[model samples]
Target chain A: MNKMQQRLLHPSKATRQDRFGKTISLICIGFIMILTVSIIGFIAIHGLATFFENHVSVMQFIFSSNWNPGQLGKNGQPQVGAFAMIVASFAVTLLAAILATPFAIAVALYMTELAPKRGAKMLQPVIELLVGIPSVVYGFIGLVVIVPAIRSVFGGTGFGILAGSIVLFVMILPTITSLTIDSLQQVPDHYRKASLALGATKWQTIYKVILRAALPGILTAIVFGMARAFGEALAVQMVIGNAALTPTSLTSPTATLTSQLTSQMGDTIMGTLPNNALWSLALVLLIMSVIFNLLIKVVGKRGEMKK
Target chain B: MTTNETVITTKDVRLYYGEHEALHGINLDFQKSQITALIGPSGCGKSTYLRCLNRMNDLIHDVTITGSFKIDGHDIYRPQQDVVSLRKKVGMVFQQPNPFPFSVYDNVAYGLRVQGIKDKKIISQKVEESLKQAAVWDEVKDDLTKNALSFSGGQQQRICIARLLAVKPDVILLDEPTSALDPISSAKIEEMLLQIKDQYTIIIVTHSMQQASRISDKTAFMLNGDLVEYGDTKKIFLNPEQEATSDYLNGKFG
Candidate 1:
């Protein structure tokens, strides 16, 4: 073969660089996969230890509200029930999502349809700034302002599911709003024009056509916001009162899985039941996050299929 | 069929998009129950002018319009003229077959439902009649609940026409409704327009000269934001008054 033909057919400097680039990317991905798998595996092993090694039945761990892991209950079973925390987590996440969704949709509509220039130039940056603010700052604000506000209104220590939901509402508002704006923008402009051309009023077109077309995407956005609210640690912990009790009312003290885990993780001995219980909580959080991710994927796939 | 009865009259209509004038003082009168074709090259403001008739251009920001637009001798641009009702009297179909990502039944009944007609029986009856009027009933009769976007482009376009017909507007403005379709679909739409011409005043913006001559009762040729020629389709095609009209018709230049 000629020199040029041989260079084209065989490994050259460019080919070496290509292989090197591929190897580097592959190594990076491999490292990430290993890190992720090991993290999940570590959490899983320790989390299952509560039921396996400690002999805590899954039903007692999940359904029993008596969560005193350091001692045995009257029934001779370990009191490691996560029912309250699970309920509180769901309550806070759902309340926050419900409180935030309408506001997010309104802001997104204002940005995408009503006043795009003002939204892009003014509101977009403000929302991005809200997202950039550290979660600790949000926690601090919740602790000082929201707690006292609730105390004055509801006659409590001001630390409860209400305060936590309010804090999470603020925290996840920007996330939901930005994602909602993206979904609203994804709706084809032709839909708007078609609706308007049919003699539909602007409000009718927005509600009937634009919002309907963006339903799945908006649902995905709300789910993502719920995920953020569910997994949040520091902010929710500060406002949620850190009480290991069942929430009876909106203004009552409660403990979410994340808040409980964060509060108890540092205090427990390394190999104790308390520590294993915290790991179990972490496992719940991990599973919930996976479920959230799957929900987003399913929603996105359903939206595409409808299209 | 030249008629003395004018349905829509626009005298000296000018439109500007952020200081860039798109339509320059266009004056035209559309007759009642007649198909008028506006033929032009791209960016000649044909679609822009059509949008003005129904005040659809009001949706765009930084758009300044100056002129008098009257429908049935009532000034439609008046401050008290209620754009919503004006649009009900004047409907538009776009170049793309834009059906709401909904069922065919919902898509056709959308206009009626917008007017707050909540009776299901009336809505279904109107939807069926509109679909049949638009010549798409036979194809979509079995799949009324199927999503309109799931259909082929041609069927989707027909569904859009049905949507427009469901509103029962006196004037129908189509902005190159067949430009995005194949020849057979275009022919179908042309035939459907001809069938409905006696019921509504139809104004179409088209690039195909053959389409204009084949379907339009009167053809108006526009160039560079100016109405260059306006007359009978046969006269404009066979014996032209302006040099530019013949030139464009012969494919000499756009």
Candidate 2:
């Protein structure tokens, strides 16, 4: 058909709807992109000078892990060391994630598959309530309860990386369990039924088919959980004892970048250096979180595409 | 015909999904070494009846079935009955191609593996024999290691058949196995069904009147969850005893 005839036959209303939908969606996406760029620009503008300053070497900052630097020469003042803080942060986060994973999966499984209707109805609200509780309360509990318990067992030093990890583990449990339950629930009912119908036992059906199919989603949940654990701040500070020295064990006094930044921000001598370091630490933390989230999304999307 | 050779029989069976009754006290006999086709419209309970033969309907929550369903002269609905063995003896193929996401050989070997038959030689032999019986060995033999989902729609359906056959079930239940396939695929499935009828009792539920006439030795016409007529396939197709059955066969109504 000729162009004019085709235009008349097709009608402009359909094309107009498609164009309008595209324009509206583009506007929404553009708004979010602009907001992100603006925030990143602000952080980079304030912190770009630190990257160039000879006062702090990049290798010394990352590799040596000695965070404290002097306003004068090495002979004039003692430099604050950060090796302990970095190691303590990673050690505590790893411990928390490992301790919480199995319990989270069991809670998720019970919530999704085995719990009775009334029990699920009651447990769901309680689990969701855990999410809304303020982080400070969990920290307070760690101070009053977990610290003392550890002290009683490990000679009464109530503050350390272990205490901080226990607190953070409790704080992030709800997030991991809820995400796991969502992933398990999304597995197709037919896969379960088909497995069961093939004369496989109930546990076999879940392990061989349900869990196999839901692996990507479960892995995503774990990565997100680890990301949350590594970035937690106020709660970690309260239980970690905030010592500037490196911790040799879970019970040893130490500090995280967050706690160090908070403590040093108040000192008059530390000034903008501590604040600048905090921003840099935040950039590192942000990059790590994004990497993990991207990993989860990529794996989950691949699984969905295969299906 | 020997009465002792029957594969599956139901006596005044009643099935209810919640308060609503689906099957209204139906009695039927599924014979050995023959093809029995149940033809009816959607929601006429044909598929439900087929699931009942293998006790698959028991999986539905809040469903209650009364009366006796027996296979090899044993009551399948008995409280003490072992559903695992029952399912192994009476395998089912679904309306859609529901092949497991695995290699073609693995799909065929799924049943054997579930039964704890771990010998590598036995599994390989059974997988090949089952694929051959389903008439898909030659087409898939070269690519047995490839994912079953890579196959065409017809080939996937046949792979499902091969999977079920590897279980060595005495009775095979098919629910509109070819309704999802094209005409050529449907014809291939019909021919394969005819070839395998001698080794196993085959009960197929179909919507197509022509398929029922072509492949079935015995045909049962059903409407609204009740059997209207049942007899030899040739007699039912050409001269049905009931007016409703004839009307359905003649394309007057379904």
Question: Highest lDDT, which number?
Answer: 1
> Which predicted model would earn the best DockQ?
1
lDDT of 1 at A222: 98
Q: What would the per-residue lDDT of candidate 2 be over residues A1-307, giving only the tens digit for each residue? A: 5998988888598888999999999999999999998877766654443555435555555555455653533654224335666788788878888888888888888877777476578778988898888878888888889889988998648789899989888877888888888888988776666665566666766776667777777777777777887888887888888887678778877888767666666663323565566566656566667777789889889678546
Give per-model TM-scores: 0.97, 0.89
lDDT of 1 by residue, B1-254 (tens): 34548889998989999989988898899998789999988999999999999999998889999989989999998889888999999999999999999999999999999999999999999999999999999999999999999998999999999999999999999999998999999999999999989889999999999999999988999999999989888999999999999999999987
Candidate 2 residue-wise lDDT, B1-254, digit = tens: 54436778898877899999898878888888899999987898989988888788977889888888888889998889888888888888888887766689887888888889999999999999999989899999999998887899999989989988888889999999999999998999999999988889999999998999899989988788787787889999888888888777777875
DockQ of each: 0.86, 0.43
Residue B216, model 2, lDDT? 94
Q: Candidate 1, residues A176-246: lDDT per residue as tens digits?
A: 99999999999999999999888898899999999999999999999999999999989999998989898
What's the residue-level lDDT of A159 in candidate 2? 87
Candidate 1 chain B lDDT trough over 10 residues, lowest sum: B1-10
Clashing pairs in 1: none
